[model samples]
Target chain A: MPTVYITAPRDVAPEIARTLVEERLAACVNRLACDSVYRWDGEVLTDEEAVLLAKTTDERYAALRDRVVDLHPSEVPCIERFDESDILDAFGNWRAESVGEG
Target chain B: MPTVYITAPRDVAPEIARTLVEERLAACVNRLACDSVYRWDGEVLTDEEAVLLAKTTDERYAALRDRVVDLHPSEVPCIERFDESDILDAFGNWRAESVGEG
Candidate 1:
């Protein structure tokens, strides 16, 4: 299974999160308010942001990524996938069911 | 590098997050408020929770996990690690420095 981490501007996170869940691309989306610090265009900057941890399986990752990119506000959004091997069985089953695999 | 996901009640998240950073077990921690649903004791339960995404290197994961478990309120807290191979170099360097690896 893969948990996709997506960073979005605070204002737009809810919409993006809703779309991913509604489209069945993700089983669940955990939205967190955060401060992102990074170097962009030769300058280091920090901004208030929201991160969405989207739970989905390998089979659905590509679609979820595409949908996130399409709905995101940034030209090059930070969409990273972390493959997990130790997921709890019950949570995994729930995720599978949510994405129509179960 | 690994990002450790830890779930705790909202009230305790800040203290746990602060300890992880202060001890240099994690470079940074992103705290997010969310709902967690799962089966416990043969009953499905839902609760408000805060998740901490703690960024650390492989070398520090064990210590971080131990510290988190000690500081956490739950007996068996959710402490999961996701290793990353596609991390941005700049961010990785920053993480390394923050954890005194640089």
Candidate 2:
């Protein structure tokens, strides 16, 4: 299983996160408010954003990613994958069950 | 190189992030406000927290982890390691140099 890390516009992230959970692509989504600093057009810019950590199984990752691209307003969305190196067994079970996995 | 994922009290997160950056334990720390839901002592609880994503190198991770543990007030702090699966070359270079890895 992997947790997908994604950054999206602050105004748009909540709905997208809810959609993923409602559609069963993720067991749950953790949304966080952030200020993302990056270099764009040769200038450093800081923009308000949200980071979504979606707990999902590997089987659903591709679909989750595609849906994010479909919903995200950014032209080049920031999506990163992280393997769960360590996790509490009970929480893992809960997450797996929530996602309709074993 | 890896990004350390840690959770802290919302009020304490900012200072911890700043200290890590100032002490060179991390090149930068991304802070985000979140509400974490988990089962504690047979009760499900949701607590407002801050997520600290600390960018550091392999050689520096142990030190970073120790520093985070020291600063975190939680009896058992949440600190997870994530290897960079893929990153933009220029960004990677900057991150590496920022942490004194390059």
- Which of the numbered candidates is closest to the native, going by highest lDDT? 1
> Which candidate gets the maximum DockQ versus the true structure?
2
Using all chains and alpha carbons, the TM-scores for the candidates as numbered come to 0.60, 0.58
**CA lDDT of every candidate:** 0.80, 0.78
Candidate 2 falls in which docking quality class? incorrect
Write model 1 residue lDDT over B27-83, tens digit each, in one string.
767777779999999999999998788888889999999999899878999999877
Q: Per-residue CA lDDT of candidate 2, range B8-92, in tens?
A: 9899987888777766677667778888999889999999998888877787899999989999898899999889664434445
TM-score of chain A of each: 0.93, 0.91
Q: On residues A10-53, what C-alpha lDDT tens digit does candidate 2 reach at each position?
A: 99999999999998889999988885544334333457788899
Kindly report which residue stretches of model 1 are placed more than 4 angstroms away from their true locations once superposed: A1-32, A35-48, A52-102
Task: Give the clashing pairs for model 2.
Answer: none
Question: What interface RMSD does every candidate have?
Answer: 5.1, 4.6
Q: List the residue pairs that clash in candidate 1.
A: none
Span of ten consecutive residues with least summed lDDT in model 1 chain B: B84-93
